[model samples]
Target: MPAQPSPAQSAQTQLERGNGPEPSTLDAHRCQEVACGNVLRDLYEGLVTEDAQGRLVPGMAQRWTVSADGRTWRFVLRPGLRWSNGEALDAGQIVASFRRAFAPATAAPFGELFDALDQAQAVQAGRVAPERLGVSAPDPRTVEFRLNRSASLPALLTLPIAFPVYLPAVRRHGAQHTRPGQLVSNGAYTLAAWTPQANLQLRRNPRFHDAAAVAIERVRFHVTEDAAAELQRFAAGDLHITEVVPPQPLVSLRRRFGAQLRLSPYLGAFWLGLNTTRAPFRDAPCAAGATRCDDRALALRRALAMAVDRDKLTRYVTGLGETPAYGTVPPGIAGYTPAQAAWSDLPQAQREAHARALYRYAGYSARNPLTLELRYNTSTPHRRLALAVAAMWRQTLGVQVRLRNEEWKVFVQNRKQRAITQAFRGGWIGDLADARNFLAAFGNDGPLNWTGYDDAGYRERLARADAAATDAARNAWLRAAEQRLLNDHAAIPLYFYTSKHLVSERVRGFQPNALDRHASRWLSLSP
Candidate 1:
């Protein structure tokens, strides 16, 4: 008889993260992509998690208790939890991870998530030590968080950055701990191999907390930025799930693979981010100068923002269903009322005329026009959208706008630099369901606020909202704050995204949610 394959050698589930070929970071503390979140969720457990229906469910802490004032929270860890290396994963690790997330040295991009925790802001600002932050381990199995104020926190705990960091692995390997072979994880899968710019292999972790319930034995992430290429892989039977359905063949594929094609609205927005600290975008461009950023710079931004036709972009360029974005916060997030963005209600001709006038007022004309570059990450849909917007700018404002593209990981790193490229594409698939979740990243010194948008009035409004006594009051203040940001033209709202994925027929238990988060741990493949 022919030699039989070992039991370990079996069929695997394959998936893709973003729309293109980009190798995102693996460290939960540093990772930011939604796809990265998907994998990290499988690899690490948070205090709480969202079910496929978007409801919060118990995770590392099987159950929790909150103080009446909401400033103190106590999480009781599930017993016998162990890391992939078989070390006890306890409250101490959870406490350490929370501290590391806000520690200035760790440089976690989502550090702003700790804005509510006591003394974390000071620690994040380098004014205090990370050890001074409020989280502590009251016992071997209990982690407590003391907050600055009483507000919603459960949703915040579900963020990827909140995942416990296994300190022993980090200390041993330093920055390279998350590398394939040296990793120690506590999730459904462990890193098997990572080939830069090609693919990443993940083997099911036999030591996972819920290992018995994890159906998929193996998983592979085919790193790619090309939407068309992803479609090709799906057709070739290489990818079991593709991140984006190519715009060109979306309709045909829906008909050809009816059961495999999934389309649903996601809680996200695609917009244009202007780096307000740079030349042309900033009037003074001096950090310590007495002269404030000129209003004319904002005028230029408003001119460009008004020129975008979101309705056309959603209908023509985005073949998959998407809604025109009037504001940063999408329509259905609980406790938030959408604020009217600039030019949302203006007539087409009037808006065009106003944009041209603003451009002229900002010292630009056809003879001596202001030129700028537009940057975006790789993806066919992104390319088409950039081109469409470029054409609109040329037609409406007569300004010279060039289009540029970069891979996802490199692009994210670029966006974080203080001296970012003049203008770039930015979007957010929310880490939590709240208006602040969308707005917090734009704070004066927020890690994601590369734009250098600092306004005392806006800051006050945010503070008021965060401290609001009730959800209703909180939302009112948030709405006002959002309106102020739009008036300043902090970012150009384009369109809200709709997720379209290619799920193979063999897979099951993939339920769509507004967050568009689907962890591979919950999935099973037919024999």
Candidate 2:
């Protein structure tokens, strides 16, 4: 077991404040990838947290009081927490930083994610003054949000990136200077250095209220794309954490360092998206029909779901600690419940009948077969899963899928283009724990709704849920919307997610959450 840190340990006093270069901007709005996100996290803090179970919890705001109507929340900021540059952390900064994020020039991918904030949409549209943005820090120690509606307030606050407190110092520097050392942050750790494509170094932030509790004096994030290379590097003691490792290597790790090989799913679900606006998919009856394309897709989806052999996949693809997914929501989130319908093996005769009927409906002659293209990233485990799925589709649906492979970057771009591939694989980590996060992707105007399925009735239901007055009522509408999605076969649910990490024996007091925030506030290391 890793040696842990105590909450009251005297924080390292040798560190100097603002030892790095001065920043041109203190904002985190323009960062693009995971590496940039890790860099910016050090400088910002949010009001809520997505815990290990993918549940929302209080963050910088110790707690909040909500009105019965759910339109307002009074957040009490933690006292005496300061940014690394010595500015007293206050509510005014939160208001200013968020206002800047809404600016069109900032082009923040998360600009819409914060629409729940008071007057946020209005402010973004230039209809309101930035100061009237609904977030008021009446005093240096307090902040309050006047919301537009009632729904997942805390989860909305736990976005994966940005939402950090910004200082006036950053607005002057602007987006151009918002690099690693150019800014001061208010999180559990501070940026030590970032060597491109190598490692990102972070050390404890003395100004953080809970800094005394941080266990690791220095943390290093090594960027390696290959799973086999990552595990080999881990065994050689070259890295602290390696993610998305392949199954065969994971088995060897468990056999050798059983306790160190941690296993958990991230809060995400992989699925096959059908471009409902194009091709045979565009024809609603054809899409929903028992004909070849529709029928083959449904049978293939079901057969693939049932034949996945989740236990084997979990043991190999995920290294255990993962549950087979029957729905979009992962197992541990508050509203997630497994669907009553289970996918089990069908009799060979029935399977053949279904496949034949589907092919016939798809307009295929008796001798012809329905074929489509499938695309996935080239990760070793993903390769295995894709091959398994392809094989299952062939045997059960009698449909042959041509597998297309690409690097992670290219594959993502292809999906965005709605390219030639018929079915593409992907998942999203819940930015917050709302069912809306899942259902919204299917909504007509959902920003991330890559599937391009537009259902007017479903869209209305989503709007109603968003406008509901109570969490209970809102969640009920959201669940009904989910049922509609399931009944419609909008997308196939692959598996719920868990994050996996392997901590060294010397690293202590580490806590992993589905939101992927490293809560080192209470961590400390033994000498």
Best-fitting candidate, measured by TM-score? 1
Per-residue error at 397 for model 2, in Å?
Answer: 4.0
Please give the lDDT score at residue 246 for candidate 2. 49
Q: Top lDDT: which candidate number?
A: 1
The local distance difference test score of each candidate is 0.81, 0.60
Q: Show where candidate 2 strays beyond 4 Å.
A: 1-43, 49-59, 79-81, 110-115, 119-132, 165-175, 249-253, 264-266, 284-319, 335-356, 364-371, 398-410, 417-422, 468-472, 512-516
Error of 1 at 39 (Å): 2.1
Off by over 4 Å in 1: 1-9, 12-21, 283-294, 418-420
Q: Tens digits of per-residue lDDT for model 2 on 222-306? A: 5565566666777786655565554565556688877776665466776666555555444434555455543544443333344
Candidate 2 colliding pairs, count:
23
* TM-score versus the correct structure, for each prediction: 0.94, 0.78
